[model samples]
Target: MADVYDTTYGQADYFGSEASPLLARYADWIPAEARVLDIGAGQGRNSLPLARRGCRVTALEPSGVGRAAIKAQAAEAGLDLDIVGENFMSYEPRGVFDVILCFGLVQILRYQECASLVTRLHQWLRSGGTLFLTAWHVGDPSFARLTREWERLGIRSFRSPDGSQYRLFLEDGEILKLFFRWQTIHHCEGLGPEHRHGDGPPERHGEIEVVLTRP
Candidate 1:
């Protein structure tokens, strides 16, 4: 059974116009026809399109709500996708994929677990495979305040079904350093407090986008 945190799936759209930019950048590195793994996938936003384009897609979402959303959207789009409601720290890939996405996942665990996950994700990729990641940057003042509030509320350390706590924030160098074993293709530090469709952006929630490839 999923925990309280699991219910918060698909809360916000992290990527709006930037989705195209990330996809285009990924296309340049990943093969035209590739198997993609969307770790922490929510609602099949990016996964659905990739599957529609003829790529084999496997979305790994730990949240039941998130996984159900993936399936729901996949059917709505008529996109074939394999859904696995498994935690990232314990998720063993069936095989290496051409592209692996870790978007909006780094801050979802402890600092050490996050580090191990990056290394494991890199290992799960096939040679020349690409890994894309985006996370809320810790430098954002608004997010800092939010984290403090969540902590103050005594939910600072809520446990998930997988025994992991949820608090998402990452440093710039820590994110950039994930490419130590892989070659970096693209990296961006676009500050946004959650803006989609000219929503004029919010006051908090900025993210950093990263794309790296295994050699």
Candidate 2:
């Protein structure tokens, strides 16, 4: 995965050059000088902007090349960010945070893995902290094929262009079940245009975006 991300598609291009729309929309919810954790923080899309806004940002990424890109970008911008090159599922948090961003990552995990991670995330958040989650869903046009493949092979994944298997889609109800303990601030499910990460053509997909706060 690291090699694939590094060579085929840079994290920056996968997420684009700007902060995600979800991050930009909920910027006000993150307090200035708050401690923030960005799980699967590919190429510092949210990390860089949040750090610039006076938040203490810690970006956790599994890819070395991605982490290096994040560090380089931070240095170039003269921003101080804690870049941890580790998978979010195995990486332990040193302390609770004021905010946690989990964009473009949750759907990558198996059902049980995502459930376990969300449980940990709830515990990792400080009181009144928020969690921003975005994931691919079953409404996607490619989902039917992926589901058929999974059922036939007993594996929930689709083949990537690199010949590697990638995670399949999720349902909106399933996503809600994982974070049921938190107070939802916003929740929406809809279709979105697919933007090619590298050389592939665009393929449309369904997505769910949610913001939940710990009481």
TM-score of candidate 2 on Cα atoms, chains taken together = 0.88
Q: Please give the range of 10 consecutive residues that has the lowest summed lDDT in model 2.
A: 150-159
Report the Cα lDDT for residue 98, model 1.
86
* lDDT tens per residue, model 1, 36-127: 99887765677777887788989987767767767877788787899988877888887888888877677666666776887787678888
The residue pairs in collision within model 2 are: none
User: Model 2, range 90-178, lDDT digits (tens) per residue?
Assistant: 88888999999998886666556776777888789988899998988778777777665543222444544444546656666666787
* Top lDDT hit: 2
